[model samples]
Target: MSHSTNLSHHSRRIDLDAPLHRKAGPMTHAMQPVESAGEAQTSQACPTPRYLTNSEAAAFLRLSPRTLEKQRVIGGGPRFHKFGRRVMYAVTDLEAWAGERSFETTFDPEYIDRHPGVQRDDQ
Candidate 1:
């Protein structure tokens, strides 16, 4: 129920009774980088849904976290799940919702009226 981490500029172990991706109080840990490129490739080959905190999901979607919170309240953000009191988003759901909002032009109905800041970048 604990994982290896280096917090407070010192090596320590942290309990993970909840999901590892969730922030522990004010302390949030980033995915630890591997020691070698081989490890990086290995990790990428075994893809996992990266669970994101609301703030992290907001950064990933180029929105303010407050916007996500509002979306949660009023409905219609990317699908998210609650781990008890914690709210977590899956990368897959975020990508799917972003894909759903993709539009070709700024004048597209959904683009202008509904999802103002989102557009399909065909790149």
Candidate 2:
């Protein structure tokens, strides 16, 4: 199949920024082209391989980057790595962290019954 047909008809770029509630698939929009501000060039230089910065990762989670950083400091946020002075967020980590809570909604009732909560006589 031709590459053009594989792309969304409404948008040439894949719509990666859409939330997790959307269909699960490879990003559907074409990558947005970015240019370095300091360099002068006639052709569009390729975008650097995108890694989620603190702000970007926070945005991905719909929280402020500072809050995400706080979570990281508290050991409550998604896993991250340091590349020199830059902190890089893993896409898999972000996805896993973002989706992990949803699993709690579909629990096995028998399991919960077996593992009952704090015992109380006020039944």
Candidate 3:
């Protein structure tokens, strides 16, 4: 089976049968905005909520879903909400949680104060 792929910036088509690495130049394609009827209807019905699921929140923070689950069980996780038995994380809460952990260095005195459970190597 052969497939035709369009190259960006150049008016040339590459065949799938050819060696991809050799024929396919820079893999950069500009994305075009698309609007569908469903999207319009949904927007008109209600504004989208800035909430993410456990997996999505984990991905946004570059953490594993298991880690988030553990944090939820133990402590020190971002603020979450329960909407009809569904756990959701707000974008603002995630941002605030991440912001709180920011420090200039590991040995910063504030780090020890914020995380009292942590043990410093020096100590």
Candidate 4:
């Protein structure tokens, strides 16, 4: 089998049976061609937001949907938005909330600040 490739305004035929050789050069975004103006406008006209449902958000965060519902009612959970009567979670908000809980150690200063009742040997 053979394949035709167009590079630098020149068409070349490649023999698939031949052994492939690596070329040392800077990587380029040639594989991803630039979007045309019409395509860009169409995308802009119907932009899709990254919103997840309660169950999907829970799955993404590795938690139970019931836990998220409880948090929504009580407190302590990622930020969420309500669309009419539906609850929605944005990926960015989830990431930010998870980022806030990140700690280098169990006794991290920020963690201690968030949980003042937590006793630390250094205290």
Candidate 5:
């Protein structure tokens, strides 16, 4: 991981070699890096973790945006922060929320409800 200065007089450290391409696609012609709107939206940082938007968080949780929104409104979902009009979910918070929903039985949706002192996997 190499950090270099941007093309200016200033020597501020910035990583430019990080791949922003989302995924590699099948080549129909000469192989070229296919850049899309999604790729453009992604950050190119290596060591730093970025926040997830509503869509990104929903995708990360494998749920629909509407479902995540509903959970947020009802106050039983991953913790989130609001920056002006934008809603953001931290990666750690999302992971913790998902971990809390885990159970030994897949059929029991009310397992957490029935069991009282069951701690999360973190314990």
Candidate 6:
């Protein structure tokens, strides 16, 4: 099969739990600004801090929020701070944490053989 077919097949199998929310198209005429009163009430609903929230941190790591909390208790996650009862993570620290976990592979001939079509490509 062609490379494009292979890429399309691979892309179709993607399964991500946390997907980014997006609008389908450009704004329509029906889109109206809410009144200031409604805006004030909406803003009051669970105030998220200027810093990264637990959900944001989890999204950054591509993990569930509970998993992040578990890592925090076990000292396995990036360093964070508590602002009162709420836990906050630094964007820079999370980036550093991701970088530290990155790994480089040392390809082996046997390993290549285990992957379909890889051996054919090699030789």
* lDDT (Cα, tens digit) per residue for candidate 3, span 3-109: 87766669677675544534343222322123346866886799665788998788778899999999999999999999998889988899899998899986798
The residue-by-residue lDDT of candidate 4 on 14-86, one tens digit each, is 8753435323332224222245468778868987767889987887787999999999989999999999999
lDDT of 5 by residue, 1-123 (tens): 889866787767756534543334422234233445575456453435558899878877778999889988897889999999999998879889998878779447577565554545427
Each candidate: RMSD: 13.6, 14.0, 9.5, 10.8, 15.7, 18.8
Report the Cα lDDT for candidate 1.
0.78
Q: Better model by lDDT, 1 or 5?
A: 1
What's the alpha carbon RMSD for model 4?
10.8
| TM per candidate | 0.54, 0.45, 0.58, 0.57, 0.52, 0.46
lDDT of 2 by residue, 1-119 (tens): 56555444566554654553454543343322233344325333653444688977876777898988888788768889899999999767888887754534325554354445622
Cα lDDT listed for each candidate: 0.78, 0.64, 0.77, 0.77, 0.72, 0.66
lDDT of 1 by residue, 1-123 (tens): 889775778666766643554544433434332234575687689787779899988877879999999999999989999999999999889989999988888777877678545544432
Best by TM-score: 3
Query: Candidate 1 has which clashing residue pairs, if any?
Result: none
When summed lDDT is taken over every stretch of 10 residues in candidate 1, the lowest stretch is 26-35
Question: What does candidate 1 score on TM?
Answer: 0.54
Candidate 1: where are CA atoms >4 Å away? 1-42, 107-123
The TM-score-based order of candidates, best leading, equals 3, 4, 1, 5, 6, 2
* lDDT for position 64 in model 3: 100
In candidate 4, stretches whose alpha carbon ends up further than 4 angstroms from where it belongs are 1-48, 120-123
Total clashes in model 3, counting residue pairs 3 or more apart in sequence or in different chains: 0
Location of the lowest summed lDDT over 10 successive residues in candidate 6: 26-35
lDDT score, residue 65, model 4?
Answer: 98
Q: What ranges in model 2 sit over 4 Å off? A: 1-50, 103-123
Clashes of each: 0, 6, 0, 0, 0, 0
